[model samples]
Target: MPKMLCRCGKVVGLGEIPSSNQWMIISDTMITDEDWDDNGLNMSDFYKKMDIVVKCPECKRLYIYSKGFGNEPEVYNLEE
Candidate 1:
């Protein structure tokens, strides 16, 4: 599998972002798993929202993940 990355074309996976709610996604709601992709997908459907996306550089990994916001968690954990 590919790794996480930065918009600057840099890989950031295998390590943490050092904090939550500080990272970006590369693509919208089309991740590695059907379920994980669906979490953001369902939310988008119900709330008419789009999942934030990010692309991994070296691995070309695309992410449709987000951090939570107050009252509502912006991101949800995926099931592997």
Candidate 2:
């Protein structure tokens, strides 16, 4: 597991390279190369499919999962 420290001095858990590649945390904003202009400057595509994903330092507060799109990890079951 890779350990990344947050600004608050907490060790963030990036346990496994996510079980599924289709899912990623939308941590920031980004535009892919294909969307760049002639000068290589990225053309705006905020509402498009391009995005920047990263591990949130605070998982408890910023975690999100898709119930139908990706396979959920098999950890301890959580009951409501």
Number of the top candidate by TM-score?
2
Position 35, candidate 2: lDDT: 42
Model 2 lDDT, residue 45, Cα? 36
Using Cα atoms with residue i matched to residue i, what is each candidate's TM-score against the true structure?
Answer: 0.25, 0.27
lDDT of 1 by residue, 1-80 (tens): 13443554575543444423234443455444774656555644533333344444444444554442213223233344
Candidate 1 residue pairs in clash (backbone atoms < 3 Å): 25-53, 25-54, 26-53, 26-54, 26-55, 27-53, 27-54, 68-73, 68-74, 69-74
Q: lDDT by residue for model 2 over 5-65, one digit each (tens)?
A: 4444556655566522223433244444544554754334332343323234344222233
Lowest-lDDT window of 10 residues in candidate 1? Answer: 68-77
Error (Å) of candidate 1 at residue 8 is: 15
* Model 1 regions lying over 4 Å from their true place: 1-48, 66-80
lDDT of every predicted structure (CA atoms):
0.42, 0.38
Best by lDDT: 1
Error of 2 at 20 (Å): 10
**Displacement of the residue 26 alpha carbon in candidate 2, Å:** 7.7
Error of 2 at 37 (Å): 24
